[model samples]
Target: MSELASGVQVVRGEMQPWSDQATPHPALAALLTDVVPANRRTLILGPHAPQQIESVLAHSADVTILVRSVADAQQLGEDFGPCLQVIAGALDGLQGEPYDVIIATDGLDRVLGYDSSDLSWTERLGALAGLAAPDAVVVLALENEFSLLNLLDSRPADERHGDDEWRPLHDDPTRPVSVDQLKAALPWRAEVYADFGSRTFVRADVAAAARPGELPTRLATAALESVDVPLLSPAAEGVDSACRAGLLGSIPTGWVAIAGAGATRDVYTQTGEAVLTADQNLTGWDVTITGDATPAFDPAVVPTTVPSGVSVETVLFRLAAAEDVPAFRKLAADLGEWATTSRVILRWDDVIFDGESFAYGVSPWVTEEPVDKEDLLAAAWSRFQDRLIGQHRRHPWPPWMLGDDLVSAWLGMSGIEPPEQLQATSPDTAPAAAVQVARGKELAAALGVLLETRTDTVDVRTALAEAEEAKQELFELKGHVYGLERTLGFRNKAMKTRENRIRELRGQLQRLTTAHERIRGSRTYAVSRVIFHAAQVRKPKTVARKVARRIRKR
Candidate 1:
């Protein structure tokens, strides 16, 4: 996260010079390139030398760089050589010469590392006041107290480092160094200038901006065009109203306090590139499409005629690391598939890494209706849900503004609308996601009821679906158990019928045996045997043979 503070690396600790801090801020570079006198005494206090410092060193003869870390000083000396004497020492130890120029844009928080410096920012300012040469300039960049960007800040204020020592603002709404405080603390008269987009500061001489409404647009355009980072302007109405009410210069990312010179030298710069002034005096133009914060897409390229005029615009986004490149590749693949098969005729082309940021372009493939706010959101929202969401292999991803949806993001950045932060559910049923989704519902519900507000229909639906899916699974298991119970009941009734049939058969057998036994034992059985004997006696030889056979048988 070692990104540009005043359009240059706010080189704090290690691990960054590898990241966004790879390049110096152009505005700060311009400032140093302009102000650094030839062969004049100068002292730069920092962790590592900024690029502009080296440029200034090339011109100066008596240059001394007092860096915090001994290792950093050695590294800087190795990196920048005999052009400047890199000293590994504390600010208190720096003596023997008064510097003509002292540029400590990165604050005291970085200057005094683990070593506890009892001096506060103002105290440090007073200490710095001791080293300033007559007619010398003291340029210090400090974070603004009333910056709207602070409200939208996603990252924590401090990391491995300590507090932002020279920051005029505090997150706990702690005391900020007032103009009077700075005035009282510094030896020279100080004029604080609003450094917007941190490229240049508004001169105290200018009093107020010629156009205040344009500050928001300027803020966005500055970040995108200058730093190549998408910076959304505040969407708060009160912020804009404040700007309209002569508070445009009041709110800033940071301020440059140029001492030793008063409001006469209020502003200083050799303008690198002027942002938000691309369409300065266009008289009148039709089909004007200004980027609002509610961006439907980002990393998109579009082309259209401004009625009689013609122009093309492109917005590029940088992926944080190499691992994220594949997700964009997958997005391109899905977009291509959607273009070839679906009703949408949008095509994504020219995907390339621009060294700094991932560069990709998108354009409509066919003749279509001119894109409007609603239609753009509608088309993009549909495509995003269908092709994005769970489609990317890297998802559930950190929320990103890609494709044509940057418009929604732009809207939010400009303080005009809100971004559609689509939080995709994780592939596995990680309880974390479920819990977060539940919390979101609870928040949304509470807001809806208590505040009579609405937010994130998509998130609410997603959460509800998650809960219902789990419930439906249980219902299905219950239905299966119910089916088994009905089967067992029928089998039990059949078993009882079988038992009754066995009992009836036993009773029939008993009755039949009783009848046969009674008949065999009856007296009529003796008379029937006598008649049978008389028939046998009718034949004389037969009767004698029968009697002899009976005797032999007996």
Candidate 2:
């Protein structure tokens, strides 16, 4: 092993220079806060988020991080203070004393180097266990092969394959596949967590998961919203189905096992800037929201306990789908009344109705500024409109009415006047109203893009093919029309020629008839006619016959 100037140690020939492709989740950092002790010998394995590394550093003075990438090791050494010991090599090559805490939250798959032999999952876990002290607290994450995310992915197997799968040992017979199997395979007693996106987890096994509107269902739903990948179908409906069957834990995207007790909450979720946790109490559930950043919304405005009822968003969706316009309008009125009376920032999905009264759902956000009643109503309805249209959800409204027009109509239904634009109570807040409108439209368009699945793919391709066929037909028709026009032009010239010939013949006949009339009117023709008539009286038949023959000859 050679040491660099940055104090990063390198076990030459085993270093990986490629990025490990690990995503850092704040929920993981929060979990580390609960389990990782202060001032203890700690070892972090694989490529972890910088946030996670910082959390570890804050807890332990003697911290050693093992990464297969040399560049990452050097970077970590430079970014962190001299107190951190960075090792660049495969896990097998590292020579280290047993650590009090071993964190492999990124999982054991990425710790191997380019030169390292293929290691099975069980063998990797054993290696980690060997490096841990007898009473060491170990936090390890295991990716589930049967995750809902994987099931919902519409891409073909070949398309889904990534560089990380080059040496994946998914066929290892000794590897654990389920949470129970994972717990049984562990050398020490471990508390297993169902990790969804590494942002929401069922930290403890709770019986209330089967009940709708509970922590488990809520966590799964929240995870659906956090998915960054396109899915074949809405995973929310699948998750809901799983929740109904009490099989949510069975289909976790991954499992996070803590070999020692660190997390006490029943469910843990991280939203934008805050972490929301739920702990079961005797009456119902206790929910709390905490964050490091100054909150934009008042924490007091949020509920201290879990609210029990159906989500307002779910009800709205159902009502809209059923085409129950009156019911939807009534619900909108109820929501408007609640917002106006409470004057708290509300998310449609984060509010619950218990048949009579509305309660705040467990959410990481709270709106800080008090909004005008009309604006509040407009914002909620506008967002609901976007979600409905974006998700390709069915509604009672006409097809021609959409986007802002639909939002305006919903606002009017909610008893807001002059719904063409958001009526900001103050001139200073006018910009916020405009921003809200833009944001709603942007979100709708984004959702439409993100949620486009194989259904859309097939539909679009079919439509395009039909369109192309129609275009070709139109081209052929245009060609036929041009040919017909050319033929008509030739016929018109022939008809004009025939008309000119007829006109010329009629003019010649008119001149001949005028000459005959002039001859009959002349005096010489009259005297000749009188003499012919007197001769005809003596030789009547012969003269008349001869005269008629002469006239015919002339």
Best TM-score goes to which candidate? 2
What's the TM-score of every candidate structure?
0.43, 0.72
Cα lDDT of model 1 by residue, 374-457, tens digit: 333233333333323322223323456453343333222223233343554765544432333333233223322321122222
Q: What is the lDDT of candidate 1?
A: 0.45
**Candidate 1 least-lDDT 10 residues:** 307-316
Query: Model 2, stretches more than 4 Å misplaced?
Result: 1-5, 11-13, 164-167, 204-216, 292-300, 322-326, 341-345, 362-369, 396-401, 404-409, 417-554
List the candidate 1 regions with Cα displacement exceeding 4 Å.
Answer: 1-23, 154-185, 197-200, 204-217, 220-239, 260-554
lDDT of 2 at 154: 68
What local lDDT score does residue 186 receive in model 2, on the 0 to 100 scale? 95
Q: Which candidate should be chosen as best, given lDDT against the real structure?
A: 2
